[model samples]
Target: MSQLVVEWDRLNHEIEEMTALVGKKDAEMALLKAQLAKAQTEGPGTEEVKELRVKNAALLS
Candidate 1:
Protein backbone atom coordinates (compact mmCIF):
# COMPACT_ATOMS: atom_id res chain seq x y z
CA MET A 1 0.00 0.00 0.00
CA SER A 2 0.97 3.63 -0.23
CA GLN A 3 1.40 3.89 3.50
CA LEU A 4 3.83 0.99 3.52
CA VAL A 5 5.78 2.59 0.70
CA VAL A 6 6.02 5.84 2.64
CA GLU A 7 7.24 4.07 5.71
CA TRP A 8 9.80 2.13 3.73
CA ASP A 9 11.10 5.28 2.12
CA ARG A 10 11.45 6.95 5.51
CA LEU A 11 13.35 4.00 6.90
CA ASN A 12 15.66 3.94 3.88
CA HIS A 13 16.40 7.63 4.26
CA GLU A 14 17.19 7.18 7.93
CA ILE A 15 19.47 4.30 7.12
CA GLU A 16 21.30 6.35 4.51
CA GLU A 17 21.79 9.22 6.93
CA MET A 18 23.08 6.90 9.63
CA THR A 19 25.41 5.20 7.15
CA ALA A 20 26.94 8.50 6.13
CA LEU A 21 27.45 9.53 9.74
CA VAL A 22 29.10 6.19 10.55
CA GLY A 23 31.41 6.58 7.55
CA LYS A 24 32.44 10.06 8.66
CA LYS A 25 33.12 8.85 12.19
CA ASP A 26 35.16 5.95 10.83
CA ALA A 27 37.35 8.31 8.83
CA GLU A 28 37.84 10.53 11.84
CA MET A 29 38.76 7.54 13.97
CA ALA A 30 41.33 6.43 11.39
CA LEU A 31 42.92 9.88 11.44
CA LEU A 32 43.05 9.92 15.23
CA LYS A 33 44.64 6.43 15.27
CA ALA A 34 47.32 7.56 12.84
CA GLN A 35 48.07 10.61 14.96
CA LEU A 36 48.28 8.47 18.08
CA ALA A 37 50.67 6.03 16.39
CA LYS A 38 52.87 8.88 15.21
CA ALA A 39 52.94 10.42 18.67
CA GLN A 40 53.80 7.13 20.32
CA THR A 41 56.62 6.45 17.90
CA GLU A 42 58.11 9.95 18.19
CA GLY A 43 57.46 10.85 21.82
CA PRO A 44 59.80 11.68 24.74
CA GLY A 45 63.13 11.12 23.07
CA THR A 46 63.97 14.73 22.24
CA GLU A 47 66.98 16.74 23.34
CA GLU A 48 65.02 18.29 26.19
CA VAL A 49 64.40 14.95 27.87
CA LYS A 50 68.01 13.94 27.43
CA GLU A 51 69.14 17.15 29.06
CA LEU A 52 66.75 16.63 31.93
CA ARG A 53 68.04 13.10 32.46
CA VAL A 54 71.62 14.36 32.57
CA LYS A 55 70.71 17.04 35.10
CA ASN A 56 68.89 14.54 37.26
CA ALA A 57 71.86 12.17 37.21
CA ALA A 58 74.21 14.99 38.20
CA LEU A 59 71.95 16.04 41.05
CA LEU A 60 71.67 12.48 42.31
CA SER A 61 75.40 12.05 42.21
Candidate 2:
Protein backbone atom coordinates (compact mmCIF):
# COMPACT_ATOMS: atom_id res chain seq x y z
CA MET A 1 0.00 0.00 0.00
CA SER A 2 0.99 3.59 -0.33
CA GLN A 3 1.28 4.00 3.44
CA LEU A 4 3.69 1.11 3.70
CA VAL A 5 5.77 2.60 0.90
CA VAL A 6 5.96 5.93 2.68
CA GLU A 7 7.06 4.27 5.93
CA TRP A 8 9.67 2.23 4.12
CA ASP A 9 11.10 5.30 2.47
CA ARG A 10 11.31 7.13 5.77
CA LEU A 11 13.10 4.23 7.40
CA ASN A 12 15.57 4.03 4.53
CA HIS A 13 16.36 7.71 4.81
CA GLU A 14 16.95 7.43 8.55
CA ILE A 15 19.22 4.45 7.97
CA GLU A 16 21.29 6.39 5.43
CA GLU A 17 21.68 9.30 7.82
CA MET A 18 22.77 7.01 10.64
CA THR A 19 25.26 5.23 8.35
CA ALA A 20 26.87 8.51 7.39
CA LEU A 21 27.16 9.56 11.05
CA VAL A 22 28.76 6.21 11.95
CA GLY A 23 31.32 6.58 9.17
CA LYS A 24 32.23 10.08 10.35
CA LYS A 25 32.65 8.90 13.92
CA ASP A 26 34.83 5.99 12.79
CA ALA A 27 37.14 8.34 10.90
CA GLU A 28 37.43 10.64 13.90
CA MET A 29 38.26 7.68 16.14
CA ALA A 30 41.01 6.54 13.78
CA LEU A 31 42.53 10.02 13.72
CA LEU A 32 42.45 10.28 17.53
CA LYS A 33 44.12 6.85 17.87
CA ALA A 34 46.93 7.83 15.49
CA GLN A 35 47.51 11.08 17.38
CA LEU A 36 47.64 9.21 20.69
CA ALA A 37 50.21 6.77 19.30
CA LYS A 38 52.36 9.60 17.99
CA ALA A 39 52.23 11.42 21.32
CA GLN A 40 53.27 8.30 23.24
CA THR A 41 56.23 7.70 20.95
CA GLU A 42 57.44 11.31 21.05
CA GLY A 43 57.11 11.75 24.85
CA PRO A 44 60.23 11.76 27.08
CA GLY A 45 61.88 8.53 28.25
CA THR A 46 63.54 7.39 31.52
CA GLU A 47 67.07 8.40 30.45
CA GLU A 48 65.88 11.86 29.55
CA VAL A 49 64.36 12.27 33.01
CA LYS A 50 67.59 11.19 34.70
CA GLU A 51 69.65 13.66 32.67
CA LEU A 52 67.28 16.44 33.55
CA ARG A 53 67.59 15.64 37.25
CA VAL A 54 71.42 15.71 37.06
CA LYS A 55 71.32 19.06 35.30
CA ASN A 56 68.99 20.42 37.97
CA ALA A 57 71.37 19.27 40.73
CA ALA A 58 74.34 20.89 39.00
CA LEU A 59 72.42 24.12 38.64
CA LEU A 60 71.57 24.08 42.36
CA SER A 61 75.21 23.51 43.30
Candidate 3:
Protein backbone atom coordinates (compact mmCIF):
# COMPACT_ATOMS: atom_id res chain seq x y z
CA MET A 1 0.00 0.00 0.00
CA SER A 2 2.82 2.46 0.77
CA GLN A 3 4.53 1.67 -2.52
CA LEU A 4 1.31 2.35 -4.44
CA VAL A 5 0.98 5.73 -2.75
CA VAL A 6 4.52 6.64 -3.64
CA GLU A 7 4.01 5.64 -7.24
CA TRP A 8 0.87 7.77 -7.45
CA ASP A 9 2.69 10.80 -6.08
CA ARG A 10 5.52 10.34 -8.54
CA LEU A 11 3.12 10.21 -11.45
CA ASN A 12 1.35 13.33 -10.28
CA HIS A 13 4.64 15.20 -10.04
CA GLU A 14 5.60 14.17 -13.56
CA ILE A 15 2.28 15.39 -14.88
CA GLU A 16 2.70 18.75 -13.20
CA GLU A 17 6.17 19.23 -14.64
CA MET A 18 4.98 18.37 -18.15
CA THR A 19 2.04 20.77 -17.86
CA ALA A 20 4.35 23.62 -16.89
CA LEU A 21 6.67 22.91 -19.79
CA VAL A 22 3.73 22.86 -22.22
CA GLY A 23 2.53 26.25 -20.95
CA LYS A 24 6.00 27.73 -21.41
CA LYS A 25 6.21 26.45 -24.98
CA ASP A 26 2.76 27.83 -25.80
CA ALA A 27 3.81 31.29 -24.58
CA GLU A 28 6.95 31.24 -26.67
CA MET A 29 5.00 30.23 -29.75
CA ALA A 30 2.56 33.07 -29.22
CA LEU A 31 5.40 35.59 -28.88
CA LEU A 32 7.07 34.43 -32.08
CA LYS A 33 3.78 34.59 -34.01
CA ALA A 34 3.22 38.16 -32.82
CA GLN A 35 6.72 39.19 -33.87
CA LEU A 36 6.22 37.68 -37.32
CA ALA A 37 2.94 39.54 -37.77
CA LYS A 38 4.51 42.84 -36.72
CA ALA A 39 7.44 42.41 -39.07
CA GLN A 40 5.17 41.57 -42.00
CA THR A 41 3.25 44.78 -41.43
CA GLU A 42 6.25 47.10 -40.96
CA GLY A 43 9.27 46.02 -42.97
CA PRO A 44 10.64 46.51 -46.49
CA GLY A 45 9.17 44.04 -48.95
CA THR A 46 10.14 42.57 -52.31
CA GLU A 47 8.52 45.28 -54.48
CA GLU A 48 10.25 48.05 -52.55
CA VAL A 49 13.58 46.29 -52.89
CA LYS A 50 13.13 45.92 -56.65
CA GLU A 51 12.27 49.59 -57.01
CA LEU A 52 15.33 50.59 -55.07
CA ARG A 53 17.55 48.45 -57.21
CA VAL A 54 16.15 49.98 -60.40
CA LYS A 55 16.69 53.49 -59.08
CA ASN A 56 20.25 52.68 -58.07
CA ALA A 57 21.04 51.26 -61.48
CA ALA A 58 19.63 54.33 -63.22
CA LEU A 59 21.65 56.64 -61.03
CA LEU A 60 24.82 54.66 -61.77
CA SER A 61 24.18 54.72 -65.49
Candidate 4:
Protein backbone atom coordinates (compact mmCIF):
# COMPACT_ATOMS: atom_id res chain seq x y z
CA MET A 1 0.00 0.00 0.00
CA SER A 2 2.81 2.43 0.84
CA GLN A 3 4.59 1.52 -2.35
CA LEU A 4 1.44 2.21 -4.30
CA VAL A 5 1.13 5.59 -2.62
CA VAL A 6 4.68 6.49 -3.55
CA GLU A 7 4.08 5.53 -7.18
CA TRP A 8 0.91 7.57 -7.27
CA ASP A 9 2.68 10.60 -5.88
CA ARG A 10 5.41 10.26 -8.47
CA LEU A 11 2.86 10.05 -11.24
CA ASN A 12 1.03 13.10 -9.95
CA HIS A 13 4.23 15.13 -9.82
CA GLU A 14 5.09 14.13 -13.35
CA ILE A 15 1.65 15.20 -14.56
CA GLU A 16 1.96 18.59 -12.87
CA GLU A 17 5.36 19.18 -14.41
CA MET A 18 4.07 18.27 -17.84
CA THR A 19 1.08 20.56 -17.40
CA ALA A 20 3.29 23.49 -16.46
CA LEU A 21 5.56 22.82 -19.42
CA VAL A 22 2.62 22.74 -21.79
CA GLY A 23 1.31 26.03 -20.42
CA LYS A 24 4.71 27.66 -20.87
CA LYS A 25 4.94 26.40 -24.44
CA ASP A 26 1.44 27.70 -25.19
CA ALA A 27 2.35 31.14 -23.91
CA GLU A 28 5.54 31.13 -25.96
CA MET A 29 3.63 30.17 -29.09
CA ALA A 30 1.13 32.95 -28.54
CA LEU A 31 3.93 35.47 -28.15
CA LEU A 32 5.60 34.23 -31.34
CA LYS A 33 2.37 34.49 -33.29
CA ALA A 34 1.82 38.04 -32.11
CA GLN A 35 5.36 38.96 -33.08
CA LEU A 36 4.88 37.42 -36.53
CA ALA A 37 1.66 39.35 -37.06
CA LYS A 38 3.30 42.58 -35.99
CA ALA A 39 6.28 41.93 -38.25
CA GLN A 40 3.97 41.22 -41.18
CA THR A 41 2.04 44.44 -40.63
CA GLU A 42 5.22 46.46 -40.20
CA GLY A 43 6.71 45.06 -43.47
CA PRO A 44 9.70 42.85 -42.87
CA GLY A 45 12.34 44.44 -45.10
CA THR A 46 13.40 47.61 -46.86
CA GLU A 47 12.33 46.29 -50.26
CA GLU A 48 8.86 45.40 -49.08
CA VAL A 49 8.43 48.81 -47.52
CA LYS A 50 9.76 50.57 -50.60
CA GLU A 51 7.44 48.54 -52.80
CA LEU A 52 4.46 49.42 -50.66
CA ARG A 53 5.36 53.13 -50.74
CA VAL A 54 5.78 53.06 -54.49
CA LYS A 55 2.47 51.35 -54.92
CA ASN A 56 0.82 53.94 -52.75
CA ALA A 57 2.40 56.78 -54.73
CA ALA A 58 1.31 55.22 -58.00
CA LEU A 59 -2.19 54.88 -56.73
CA LEU A 60 -2.18 58.51 -55.70
CA SER A 61 -0.90 59.55 -59.11
Each prediction's RMSD over C-alphas, in Å, is 3.5, 2.1, 1.3, 6.2
Index of the highest-lDDT prediction: 3
* lDDT (10s digit) by residue, model 3, range 1-61: 9999999999999999999999999999999999999999898899998999999999999
Error of 4 at 26 (Å): 0.2
Model 4 TM-score is 0.71
Which tens-of-lDDT digit does each residue in 1-61 have in candidate 1? 9999999999999999999999999999999999999997888768879999999999999
Better lDDT candidate (2, 4): 2
lDDT of 1 at 41: 84
In model 4, pairs of residues that clash are none
lDDT of 4: 0.95
Q: Give each model a TM-score.
A: 0.75, 0.76, 0.85, 0.71
lDDT-sorted candidate list, best first: 3, 2, 1, 4
> Which residue pairs clash in candidate 1?
none
Clashing residue pairs found in predicted model 3? none
**Residue-level lDDT tens digits of model 2 in 1-61:** 9999999999999999999999999999999999999988998888998999999999999
TM-score, prediction 2: 0.76
In lDDT terms, how accurate is model 1?
Answer: 0.96
List, in order, the clash count of every candidate structure: 0, 0, 0, 0
